[model samples]
Every structure is written in C-alpha cells, then in structure tokens.
Target: MSVTRITDVSEPLVAAFANLVPQLSSSATPPTRDEIADFLAQDGVYLFTYSNDDGAILGMLTLATFVIPTGKRAWIEDVVVDEAARGHGAGAALVEAACEYAHEIGAKTIDLTSRPSREAANRLYRRCGFVARETNVYRYGG
Candidate 1:
C-alpha cells in the first residue's frame, strides 16, 4: 500500500469522502465538496489517503499541526479504513505516514484518541508504539 497527500478536490476524493464518513462516524454527515475543498485549503492541515497498487483508496486520515505557546503539536484525526480493508495494514500505513509527516514538520508529539469499544483499532495503535496516557479527554459540545 502507498499513502499520498490529497492536494485538491476531485471526483475520486469526493467519492472517497462519501465512502469514509459512515465508517468514521455513524451520526456525522459527510462533508460537502465545498467543505472538502475548504479543508484542503486550510493551513497546517494535511489529508492523506492510503491506496493499493490499483490506486483504490483503502483508508484516510488527517494530521493537523499547529504551534501553541507550549510548543508545536500534531493530532491525528478522522482515521477510517474501509470495512473490507481492515486488518490489511491500511490503517497502520496511514498512521505511520501521518507520524512521519508530523516529525518532518517539527512537532514535539503526536496525539490521538480512540474509543474503548474499538478494540482492534486500539490494539493497532499500541502496536504502532502509542502509549495510553493517564489524562482526561473532555469534549465541550455536540
């Protein structure tokens, strides 16, 4: 599998967005084409897609890096692999790519959160050298 940064809005990417949203969240709606274009245009946000030899997208993730008063940080978000593509390294590839990119950009640390119910995903993260932190994760709004 190969991972590539998505630089522009295209039909294939729009289709991939449609295919991935349901996998990422059952309650969240897929972003519109304009929203995707806007996202791609945002500074410090990197979107990557994992694909096979035939160039079919198997997974995607976004890495957003920004500088705060403390230091530069990177967050891996919206990670989703096609249901049929799970267990075949697409997820790992995406995470590795994101981590590498974050390092390249001088991020001090990369962070991500996974639900406890996602057993396999949690395990995958552990295998990729992610340690569970003893901290509270709070969300403000729906």
Candidate 2:
C-alpha cells in the first residue's frame, strides 16, 4: 500500500471511515459522514491514508496539534488499519509519516495513548521508539 497525506479537498473522507470506526473506543461516538468532510477542511489536523495499488483505502491516521505555553505538540488521536491488512506495514508507515509531519511542524514531542487492553498497539508504539512516560494523563471531560 502507498502512504499519502490527505490533501484533496474534493476527495470524499467517507472512503476512509469504515476502516477507522471499528478501531475507536466502543463508547466513543463515531463521526457522521458530514463531520468527517468538515474536519478534513480544517488546518492543524493531518490525515494520512494507506491505499493499495487499486486505490482502496486500507488504513488511516489522524494527528492533531496542541499549542500550549511550552510549545507546539502533536498527538496521535486515531490510527486504524483494516483487519485484513494488519500483518503488513501500513500502521508503521502511518506512524512514520506522522513523525515526519510532526518534525516539519516543529513540534516538541509526539504523544499518543492506547488502552491497556490493546497490547499489540502498545508494542508497536514502543517498537517505533516511543517511551512509556511516567506522567499520568487525566481527563475531566463530561
């Protein structure tokens, strides 16, 4: 599969949704088709697609930026590869692309969180040079 940044404004984001939804938390709300298109129209969010030679989108990743007093940071919010495409390097390619993009944007660090239940994903992150930080991530969201 080939890795590409999603840059075509006229392209349909729906093409990548099915591969993404299942990878999200079960209780999380899936974006409506319209929301996907609107999100793609914004800046500071990077979406990458892994497509086969036939142009079927097999995986996607969403990276968002945070600007705080410290500096800019990048967080990997979603990463999903079609079940049938797992053994291949689509996931890795997506992560690698994010790293390149993060560097391009002068981000101080790239962070991501995976559920404890997702052992394979944790392993992949570690293998990709991510250290298990000691800091705890807290949320006060409703």
lDDT of 1 at 121: 93
Cα-based lDDT at residue 18, candidate 1: 94
Cα displacement (Å) at residue 16, model 1: 0.5
Per-residue lDDT of candidate 2, residues 1-142 (tens digit): 6888886543345745744676655666667766777887787898888888888888889899878999999999788888888868888888989988998989999999988898878888988889888888899987
lDDT of 1 by residue, 1-142 (tens): 7999899998888889999999899998999999999999999999999988988888999999999999999999999999999999999999999999999989999999999999999998999889999999999997
Clashing residue pairs found in predicted model 2: none
Candidate 2 lDDT score relative to the true structure = 0.81
TM-score of the candidate numbered 1? 0.97
For candidate 1, the clash count comes to 0
How many residue pairs clash per model? 0, 0
Alpha-carbon local distance difference test for all models: 0.94, 0.81
**C-alpha RMSD in Å of predicted model 1 compared with the true structure:** 0.8
> What is residue 75's positional error in candidate 1, in angstroms?
0.5
Relative to the unseen true structure, what is the C-alpha lDDT of residue 68 in candidate 1, on a scale of 0 to 100?
Answer: 99
